[model samples]
Target chain A: MPAGFSAADFLYILPELVLIGGAMLLLSLSVLVPRRDGLLLWTALATVAVTLVLVVRFFGLDVTAARGLLAIDSFAAFFKVIVLLSAALTLLMSAPYLRVEGIRVGEYYFLILCATVGMMFMASGVELITLFIGLETMAVSFYVLVGFLKPNPRSNEAAVKYFLLGGFSLGILLYGMSLIYGVTGTTSLAGIAAALRGQDTSLVLVLAVILVGAGMGFKIAAVPFHMWAPDVYEGAPTPVTAFLSVGSKAASFAMLLRIFVVGLPALAQEWSLLFYVLAVISMTVGNIAALTQSNLKRMLAYSSIAHVGYLLIGVVVRTERGVAAMLLYLGVYLFMQLGAFAIVTAQRRSDIIGDELKDLSGLSKRNPLAAFAMGFFMLSLGGIPPTAGFMGKMWLFGAAIDAGFIWLAVIAVANSALSIYYYIRVVVFMWINQEEPVGSPIVIGPAMKVALGVALLGTVVLGIYPQFLFEQAEVAARTLQGITAATVVGGQ
Target chain B: MVETIVFYTLSALILGLGVAVITTPNTVHSVLFLVMNFLCVAVIYVVLEAEFLAVIQVLVYAGGIVVLYLFVVMLVNLKRDPEAHQDPRRLSLVGLALAGAVLLELAGIVVYSYSREPSAPVAAAAASPVQGNVEQIGWLLYTDYLIPFEVASVLLLVAMVGAIVLAKREL
Candidate 1:
């Protein structure tokens, strides 16, 4: 016990601490409680609710604690809310499917909670080591989640592919960190920025930054490093797939923003060009690849890669407005993507697994409510106006133009237009095409219906009134301004 | 001079072990070689004066993860000759060329880096006592890096649960 290290430090981290504690509690309770039909479902909902409340209360305060490695700032708090809500929604969507598939397990919710904790820490991470640990935590948990249905050969294959690719990326990232550490002799982001000021840029440092960018690009499923996305997304359980696409991807972007904006601002001239090239490549490749994918999940996976390209446009600008737009885009993306996946979860049958594009044909006739929700989600994703997805892209590309990257913004808009073909293809098949009734109308439970409704409402409302999220994004962007501006000024 | 010789020798051994781990035909043999490679890495960590990390490298990577891999390989009951003989085809030729290209690139970078005018050693021996020792690292970990340290533990917890869930059918 050292001086000034009180229980107060632990209290500041109470939200994350509580989630970890809750996971252990749930693990024990799973044994005590009867393994009824809905036991795991109810426990998961309760855990997410308690964790969400803790996040809200923690964010309500205007305090920074844990020696700055963890910040209770609005930026981390916002992402924490997003991750929790996404996990809760995914769990809600998983209930009926898990029951149908006979794959219910207490460890499922525990892993989700733990992964959410990792995401929260990722957003708040102010140091390189913290970021790496958070990333590995998230990755390891996801590897298991992807392979949870171990008896299924496809699930096992997905897990192995994800783990190998993820492990390789981690090695690259760690190597980059070691290089940075060699140059700065420190792991703290603030210290690294300070050390970089006016220092003659070394080739080692430049290479290190590139490697770091490559690692992050892979995590976000950007082009050239996105080879694993479609297979992993297709093979994983639908709910886990939804969580990976939304919660984990958003967390990676959050960490990327923090690192590039706060830690490596002095090298903006060097890194921004790299981001620009990557953004173009990601958008072009992702859109072209997706045009041919007939598998719904695989297309979404490629579309996700393209979406990462759009988000990279924000990072390339290296401006406060760009950060805000990126955050806003991620928030909107959470709902739209999760909502689409939720509908897929509902459509699952005993014989058929994922909802292929053809499977969705004539869905409008069979389940009009689900079809309408899915339609809204697709429209939003395609960047159609008056949808949250469109508004999100608007903010992102607007920030790019504002930062004088008009060409990059133009490319993104073009990519957005190209995306519409495939996105609308799903809608057309759902509404216009016809297929035989495979089974009875899928009975969605109360929790899933509510989750879908909320996601739908969020998509429409955010699209209609983007100001609320934009304002929060603005504030979160400003929180890092002190570091960014100081670094730029010092570099000059 | 003696220290430099030892460093080079250890580096060569580590590299050799790494190559063996990758190219070995037997998966079990490859895993065993991986453990050896990990142990060599731990020795390198010790030489670098990262004592805590060295211990962790041995305990976690060499001891735990390798054992897990061995268990999986055993349970899978792979056939004695799981893979066919390597073909001397165009693809293999291309792979060899790519490997050569990578080696040349690395060599170029190393040569370029070392060509720069060498700076003074900055009293490496004296600095070692204060900076590279365990006490300094522990202080840093407890102070500025504390939150990440704790979060890493939580991450491990999640990983443990995840592994259990993946490997077992029931809770």
Candidate 2:
């Protein structure tokens, strides 16, 4: 209806458009194709391939095509790559499970792609409403995916709990947004920051900031707001759990980084204190909770929360190095979390549907490769040397200490030590703990094998050659200079 | 005077209905109350002159999502009310304490703010010549926010498949 609004703008968002188009195509193809499962897998693979290329192409391009609301900077580009890679890997891991469970359908891939797009957009969102919409997109998709195994009462329970909690969080988030809008008279993050410049602290403004922080804290599964995670993780399909633990959480962190570092930098002193408290609480609670969990998935769920706490160390610093470290940690975390989940999926035999502690008993004797991979993943998660997890923690905690958060770093490092015990417990269970075989060795599918290999390779490669990732992170961090400007404006 | 009346009325209705949505005995009734609450919020949006958002509040929240809630409620056919029996003694005391604390806090803030005159509202009359409503939202969505938007659509697609896989009689 307006001039200058060309189809070319649509081209700028080609990756997202393509994903939507691919989803629709898959929906129809599932109906047309005789073998729905094969068609779904192939379609999903094709969609991801196209999306990967688009993301790569968009990443290098210096085009900010969305009227300044949606940035196409290297920062967003880096996250786009991360989310897409995670989506592709998750889909690969999911295919085998769907096939085995005889629940293969077009919607599974479609939802995964949709959720990935949401994650990608969340990373690039410069506006509040856009970020909220993206978050909802991811969340709504997950609500369904978590309950995808509908017949299972546990799955249903998981989905219902996740949905109800997610809905409540959304309300809090929206209310917070409304308050922010009421104060700043704008929904744009930049506009809010600019308006808040030179402004004195008001009761309303303080409340708004706290509310927004609380809302985001819930999304990131920070302690006191992480109640839904363990149940959801344990109940959802293994692949969906992997996506939730890594993809969704990482996307939220992207938003958190942008909001705190770029949009509300002036409140750094205040929010950083809140983050410090959260980081300590999340790590302690998550680790302590994991220690008591017998279920492997639930343990991993709590561990993921603790990992979020560790990552918050980077946020507390609010420096360029801190942002860089956060991104690197997320990149490394994707590998470790997904790799560990893949091992869990691999351990699922015909009789057993999950990697219970008992299921992994004597895994070293039966499936030594899986056992070793599992060990490596656990070691990496524990921040053991020469693993991606260790390097990620080093960069993050190192940045915290560098920014004068020496005490926070000390606590995080201590928690990292506490974590080693539990992570090693899983390793010990697989290698040392002995139990009767419940079923024969799991028939590992080719796709899952490749997915595991990629995840493993990423962990080791990033661990060994950290420079490439570091440079990429540096570039990403540079784009976040706007955050400092935002914080100064909002804080005053 | 009219604005004050409308704001207070809408706020009370929203808060009341919101509580009802959560606390109602019948699950279906709770969902209905939620729909009512959403509608009231849409009206409040209208009062705020956010016409686009108000309409979306009705369409997405009231029409679409609330229906989903109703569907779940019906499908589940929860025989016994989940919160039918609140431990009367403890529950009522907890509720009373919460209400009292909230009221006290609200009163304090109201009293504190009563002294200061309301600041000049920003951009009260500079209606943008360019229309920026839902259409603009869509325009921005297709242009700048295209990738994430499309990704959201894909997520919905995946959700559909997942739902079918999970809900179907036999895969």
Candidate 3:
């Protein structure tokens, strides 16, 4: 154990403790008070809100606790806030949808909280073991969440495929970590960096890097490993899909950035090359495949993959500016992506299979507000001007150019243009195209409206004025820079 | 000479049983072969003087997990041969080729590392006050890896809840 570590170390993780404790309490209360389902939703939301507050309170804290298993710093706090925001919004949006679908509410909320707790842990973890546990905790919770609709055979199929593939990727990740352990004899990120500096580049270490990349690539739904995303996203409940697409993806990127930037910077050349190739492939594949997707959920899933590719370009730059841009982009994505999915949830009705693109036909005629909101989100996602998405893309691609990766910046620009086609297709469907509505008029609940309203406000505000969020991201990125500097000094 | 002979015999049994488990047509027979393979591994562990690990191999793999597999196989209907629905694709060939390449790479790494060091033989250390293998394990788990140990328990609890939620007929 590191000197001066004690039970007080738990205080550093108070937010996560509150989340888990609240989840278990809710799980038990749900059994005793099954009739008051609304109470469960509020309880879950309050837990997330309190955790968010706690995370915000620790904005500039720089401490490594649990004997360096976890590092509580600005980076972790930033990601935690993003995750908790998504969780709180998801809970707010879930109530009416759960009632409409006739699914029980208590366990659903419990699982969501647990998944958020896992994401918090993943964001905070500084040691390989801690990171792995956090990854599994989140992954396992999501497996259940994806399959929550047990009566739907499609949901079951998606769950099985996701669980099997997730478990395989996790195995590969652990193998890589074990190999690193064999080489460095330590599981701590700082220790690994200290050991790796000036060390010979062995084949085993390269293989470890490749394996780790593959595992994380799957989590973020990057190409060649993204076979599970479309099916799973389409099959899961819309709210759950929204959570998985934004919350889980953001957390995984947080973990990935930390590992590559802090733990294995010595192998930057090798991994950056890998990420560059992955970025191009993911962007091309995700955009091209999405062109043919008629299901709204499936299209969004592919778009999410493309976003991951863009995020990778940020990671590829391997600089504080690059990481800050990525963080800023994720913050923007949290709003626009969740807003898009919330609109999808609003389209759900007993008679309607809302995932189909045709279900959105003549949406402008029936519900102008929803159609406008959806159009705004799609435009933002396409990186059109005057939205968070465009500014984010600009910052990210600019970071690449600044780092002298001109070719990568060019590819990202072309990919952004390619992505605009699909994103605009959704807009055309809502605005220009007219098909006879097969279902009744979609009713937008207050909860769904609130969710969409907040998302819209965030998207528009962050777009025109990104300075505040960019400053926060810069602070977070600097915390990581401090760690790498320490590792370099310690290694010497 | 006797130790080498015993080691090779155990290795052959383990290798052959592993192959039999995969190749056998009957599910029950395949499971039996797996049990035999597990027992052979336990014996090999004993041969390496890891009695505690050997016992765990028997208890966990041979006794518990294999029995669970047996129950699952029996409960699920398998009247038709599973191979009848085989959808052989080009991907399978690519998968095989990749697997072979990985195996070769692993072999090369092992050989290169071994030749580089010719590692010195390890000497047994003095026993702790706990004395027994399990006791020592308990002590170390509680003292050195207390966080991970507790976290594992939490993981199990989450898994338990997940299983019940996913498998239950109704909420």
Candidate 4:
């Protein structure tokens, strides 16, 4: 073995390999199978299920693969499972939505699988280069997926804008990575942390940190770096938007915590201050912008940005409880965000785009079930009591308070209150505003129902009985804390 | 002294070409300037003693990517990219503020570096191993960085498939 490397290292990424193999198989079957209905969907779902099981096999593991380039720990495993679940949910909804869009390509599922695989890598990657590559994989798949609707000029325009802006942000990210490498002479997070112990804060390092923040700010759709998000969300195929909101956002948060907490714990005060500003501004801007949107997708996009801001409060806190709070919030967020988008996808038809708020008017009359699910998601998103969103927000803000950041908790609470207005507006459109008839009788396919059920169950069940999720999130966070503590001590 | 002058001349040329690539009004001229920029960057790689990197940069970036750029330019068949919509707001003050921020950051970096003791040890730069550049890189790629290398290949595969999916006329 070269430098204590073993073949067993490949065992650690077996789940990722399974996903890659399944993706290739999907693309190949697209060519060879000569099939049409539900074949790709079932296969993609099977791949996700298998990958999820494989990832669960690594639960509670705390080993480094390939000599610390990737972590195979409970922390990674937790994010991987959540990411895979979201991937499965996205695919479940994609069947009917893809049919409605008249796009039944095998490459569609393949790209989703590929993006999932990329996120899987992102959750485990311990090195900057690995994380960047994983980030690119997810980003590129989205750029193409956003434009999957070729005939629609809006889709084309969104794809171009996303590609250009995504490319620019990746450049900024890489430049920051290069600067860090220049200073530390290593690309691994632990290695960089080890090198920078007790070092004086320098301007170059500050610039590098800010650039990295800006780059990741684009990924998570924070304010001032969030110009591309609403347009991309509104223009993308609905399923893609759901996956982008939940899957991409969750994975990027994983990478963010990985970089900041697991690596830069020595500079906690500095980054804590930086993320404090990021949290406050993102919450205020995202909620304020969301209130004025007439388009449901655009509203959800801004709402998702606000949700991201709420999640950033956890990063600002940077304790075991904080990390656990983020994990809990993201878990519930996946369900609620995807559930809302599922309704949006169901409303889409051949004639009308059906994303306008007016399209949702009188939805309760057309389909009370869908309207009810949408109501649950909206309430959860607004952080009302007894919803998963509320439970998740409580833990996050509670952690902030415990960490002596009471002001942050207060700001987050105020923003959550402001956000309820728009969330309730969606509900009011569905139920109270009965004058405007929904143009057509809405149809809910079995696949979409399953997807919605999964999300609804997650949002409602986790909210009411969250002990299981709470315990698991703490175990996952414990591993992260252990590793960072070891690194800090070892470095000194 | 000679190396210093050479490095500065190449850097200045590369920066100028980069500016021209983005600023020039003509699409074809812009692409050709990009090609020149790539070539100059490859030369810089050679100057840094990474001959393999220089060759790869020439082959991949200057040769391969430029062809793709030309293909896009030809397919689009536009003299210049048309602006679809302009922001109603004239925000020159915002631009000026951003420029000032960047300038201040750069000055801070310069001043901080200059104020440091010249003999302060740079602990991060490990002593280079006595091996050929290509050999060292290859050995590391196959061993220490094998995972990232594999991931890069996967990324390229995605880009390839995505390009085909987006480019082909049919679904």
Tell how far residue B142 is off in model 4, in angstroms. Answer: 1.8
Cα distance off (Å), candidate 3, residue A349: 0.8
TM-score of each: 0.87, 0.85, 0.88, 0.90
lDDT of 2 by residue, A136-216 (tens): 888888898888876678889999999999999888878877987888787777777788777776777667667877888
The sequence of per-residue lDDT tens digits that candidate 4 reaches over residues A246-304 is 99988998898888777677666667778889889999999999999999999999999
DockQ scores for all predicted structures: 0.45, 0.27, 0.29, 0.44
What's the true lDDT of residue A349 in model 1? 71
Model 2 spans > 4 angstroms off: A1-4, A60-63, A482-492, B13-168
Index of the highest-TM-score prediction: 4
Q: What is the interface RMSD of each candidate, in Å?
A: 2.0, 3.9, 2.8, 1.9
TM-score of chain B for predicted candidate 1: 0.62
- Model 1 clash pairs are none
DockQ pick, better of 2 and 3: 3
Question: What lDDT is reached at residue B158 by model 4?
Answer: 88
Q: What share of the true interface contacts does candidate 4 keep?
A: 0.74
**How good is chain A of candidate 4, measured by TM-score?**
0.97
**Candidate 4, superposed: residue stretches over 4 Å from native:** A1-5, A486-492, B74-130
Query: Retained native contacts per candidate, as fractions?
Result: 0.77, 0.49, 0.42, 0.74
Give, for candidate 1 chain B, the lowest lDDT window spanning 10 residues. B124-133
* Model 4 chain A worst lDDT window (10 residues): A483-492
